[model samples]
Target chain A: MTRFANPKKFYNLSQKLIPILGITTLLFFAIGLYFALFHSPADYQQGESVRMMYIHVPAAWFSTLIFVFMATMSGVAFVWRHPLADLLAQEAALIGAIYTSIALITGSLWGKLAWGAYWVWDARLTSVLILLFLYIAYLALKQSMQDKPIASKMLRLLALIGLLNIPIIKGSVQWWTTLHQPPSIIRSLGISIHMSMLIPLLLMAAAFGLFFLTILLMRTQTRLLNIKTIALLKKQDQLDDPSLAA
Target chain B: MHIFSALLKHEFLLLTRNKEIFFTLLLFFGLSLFLFPFALSSDATLLKSFGPGLLWVITIFTILSSVESFYKKDNDNSLLSFYYIQKTPFILVFFTKIIAHFCLMISILMIILPLFGLFFGLELKSIVILSASLLLGTPPLITLIHFAIALTLSTQKTGMLVLVIVLPFIIPILIFGVGTVTFYETGQTLKQPFMFMAAIFLFVFAFVPWIAAYALKESARQ
Candidate 1:
């Protein structure tokens, strides 16, 4: 991991991994979708509407999971000054935001079918909404700062602050929800899902995880190339005029 | 101790000299309260029910707006470096600044809140609970804002960025603030949300100054 902290090594390594990761991602999606749509049995109570769980649950899981990953990378970037850590975090946040959107949309659709409303201020739903906002905040903060060193440090601090807030947000939302609404009978997961449903859910989650990795690697590579191009241009300009060095 | 007291006195003096921020904040708070009825239904019961949430929304926005100016004068004049040169702790200065700002802002809001409450048809009891809730909630909210402003000090546009970053983090305070009023109105014990808000205040108070100081140092370096 430390060896890959060098941008050159990371770029070289990711170049080889991207194709393999991309292929596996596609393969997993193909298989996961097949099982999710066709092979899995209809939920006993929810029936066909339960199928949305495959996409929705996985997206929700990865959305939160990616944030945790970004926060860790941010800590690494801040503490160790890992060369690719900030870049990885920046790319992961975009992917996490996309996943969060997917989760919210799919969850809304599922809610409309299951809970009779497209939106509710329910704990789970509201917390996911907040998660999406956190991602947007991260992106906005990154964009607002012009100085790279300062921006990275501040972004890391924001990420850490965000990390501390997530559990508090989740806990408070849960407490608020339970105070208002009766306990939901259909536990989204945990002792509710059967073996048949669990397979596709896990598979879809794995596929989504793979997809996140592939996109993150691609985006990080593009960022590295961008930096390289700018450096090369600056070098050429300096070579063209000796006075430019001063 | 002397430095901290002097810093507090300095911030208060500056606040007194530049009275525009005080008036602008008060005006914005009053205008937001006044506009609520116009935008929504003017019916008394409706306004009463909406009062706590409206007040909180206004309070959050007021804090955000006021915090933008908190560091602007210092940043523009490069006055923050003076503390470094004087060998004063940045955290002490940052905390003193936020405390002074919080006291001033919350006092102004509290003074004007009764009239806004009467205008919105809130009962005397509700107004008291609302004030209590704000008292418990505002410290943490202000600390969070201070930290956010520090983090965004190096940014080109700090206003919206700070709002975007700080809003979600502050939602729990909003929830509890509004909840405290609702609970009081419903004849439920106010202990729960009040305690929750107080907890948040204490938590942020304990740690946010250090974070803000660290961010201040980093921004100054840039």
Candidate 2:
């Protein structure tokens, strides 16, 4: 865990990883999209519209999945004051919010086609909506505080708390009667989803994960440069101040 | 008589003087609800079922929108330099400001809930229940908001950010706020959410002001 404590070491590691992650994401999504759109059979129930599930389900999974990951990263930043952790967490938030926005939009579109209703206040939908709000709140807290240290500490506490909604979203179907279905392949009994469908779903999920990694590394590099720039400006201000010499 | 009137006068002036702030607060309440029609589908049955929760969420946010306004005023232009020298007990000043904000929030909700009901075609009984339900639910929420506002006082421009951070802490109040109206509308007898909210209200009112008072003093020192 502390191996990432050094920013230089972390940056060097990320520098090596960026290319590999970018290519893997590219390869996985290319094959996954092919199988998802053409090869997979329709759900015996929902028919052709079931195709949207491939995109919608994975999109939903990554959104909540990445958010919880970002919250954990926020904790690392706040607890250790690891500069790399701070950069990575900030990067994760921006990417995670985008994931949530996409999931909501896609989920709504999928609902429109499949359910005859555009939106439902079912526990599942409401819980996911709350998840989106949680992301917005995290960004807001980050913007409000000027001191980065204090902001990190504050944002971490909030992220950890907001994250409780994740379980509610995942379990809402079982806990309450909701329009959304409970997890099928990931839960209970043996693997029910056909390999043709399951393979691409898992592949897309992996691609999205790598995509997040690639973007987060790029963001951290930029943030590191910004911090160094600020430090340079502070040193310049001290050097230029003549009155303080006395 | 002199000291009491002077403090009351100060608070009254603070509450009444900010026309822009007042307008902004009202606009926030109105506009937050206004977004629903555009974002949500224009279906009546859906709105009927979802309306209470949506409106409650909006009111919670509108009150949150203004939590920083008073703190911003007290922290004017580095003039906080003089706050320490002033004779009024800072705690009293803090409580007075919080009361002023709460009054504004309650008044806004009173006027807006009915308007919301009319716009969304909710029944009169639902509106009445909503009004009472919101009143019961809001105090603890506002109390929690004020506590967080005071703690983050030293860090200016924390408004939206502060709301997010404090949001989870106030979940019970929100859940109960939703539950209160749901319980009333359903005519169910579980009756626990409202009582739970009242207990939380008492807890917040008892502890929050003291915490805010301590934070206010520390901030003024800074």
Candidate 3:
């Protein structure tokens, strides 16, 4: 991990891994969609609307997962002053925000079918909405700063503070008598979901995870290249007028 | 310790000199409270029920507006860098500033809120509960706003940016703050929500100054 903290090394390594991750993500989606749409049994209570879970659940999982990832990278960037960590975190913010939006929209759609309301002030839904706002805040803060290094530093602190929402979002359903359902798949004792649903759900989660990684690498690479271009342009300006270097 | 007291005195002096913030906050609070009745029905029972939530919303907007100006003069003059150069403990300065701001704003709020409550036809008991919850809840909310301002000090537009960033984080405080009053009205023990609000205040009180100080330093560096 420390070795990849170097941008050059990360760039080289990610170049090779991106193709593999992309292909695996495609493969997972193909298999997961097949099972999700055709193979899995209809939920006795929810009927056809239960099918929304395949996409909604995975998107929700990735939303939280990407935030945790960004926060971790933020910590790494702060502690180690790793440029790659900062880049990864910056790239992850938008992806996380997109996934969070996906989760909210799909969850609302699912709610319309399952709970007979388009929205509810349920703890789970409210907290997820807050999560989306946090992501937007992170992105806006990132964009507002003119200084790159300073922005990174402040954003690192913001990310760490924002991480408090993750646990709250997770525990919201249990903490309050929410209309949103409680966690059924991952628990302390064992999986509560049936194997039929669990398999595709897990597969779809993997697909989303890989998709996040692939896009993250691609975005980070572009950012790094942009940084290098700016550096080169500054150097050229310095060369053109040596007095400007002072 | 002397430096801290001096800082507190200096902050209070500055705050007193800047009466515009206080007046703006008062007018904003009054107008928002006034608008609520016009926007919603003016039925006494309905207004009484809506009192706590309306007051909390006004409190949030006031905090956001007031705290945005707390660091304005310093940031404008780049005085923050001077503090760093002198090795002044920013955490102490920030805490003093926040305390001063809280004392001024919350006192003004306490005075005006009861009148708003009277206008809304809230019972004396509910008014007392609302004031107490505001007292407990406002510190953490101000601390959070202070943190948001510190974080976005480098940005051009701090007001809406601070709101967008800070509102979500403050929801829990708002929840428990409003919850305390609601619970009281419902004849439930206010202990739970009151304690929760106090706990949030304590937590933010202990740690947010350090974070805000760090952000101040970072933004100052820029």
Better of 1 and 3 by DockQ: 1
Clashing pairs in 2: A140-B161, A141-B161
Model 3 lDDT tens row, B1-222: 998999998898988898887887888888889888889999988988888888898888888877867788888887888888888888987888889988887778867877887799978888888889988888888888999999998888888889988967788777777777778887888787777677777877777789899898777776
- Model 2 stretches astray by more than 4 angstroms: A143-149, A164-192, A236-246, B1-62, B77-136, B147-175, B195-222
Interface-residue RMSD per candidate? 1.0, 4.9, 2.1
Chain A TM-score of model 2 versus the true structure?
Answer: 0.85
Docking quality tier of model 2? incorrect
Candidate 2 lDDT over A178-202, as tens digits, reads: 2234433222212378887888788
Model 3, C-alpha of B191: deviation from truth (Å): 1.1
For model 1 chain A, give the 10-residue run with minimal summed lDDT.
A182-191
Q: Which ten residues in a row have the lowest lDDT in candidate 2 chain B?
A: B78-87
Q: What share of the true interface contacts does candidate 3 keep?
A: 0.58
Model 2's alpha-carbon lDDT is 0.70
Worst 10 residues of 3 chain A by lDDT: A182-191
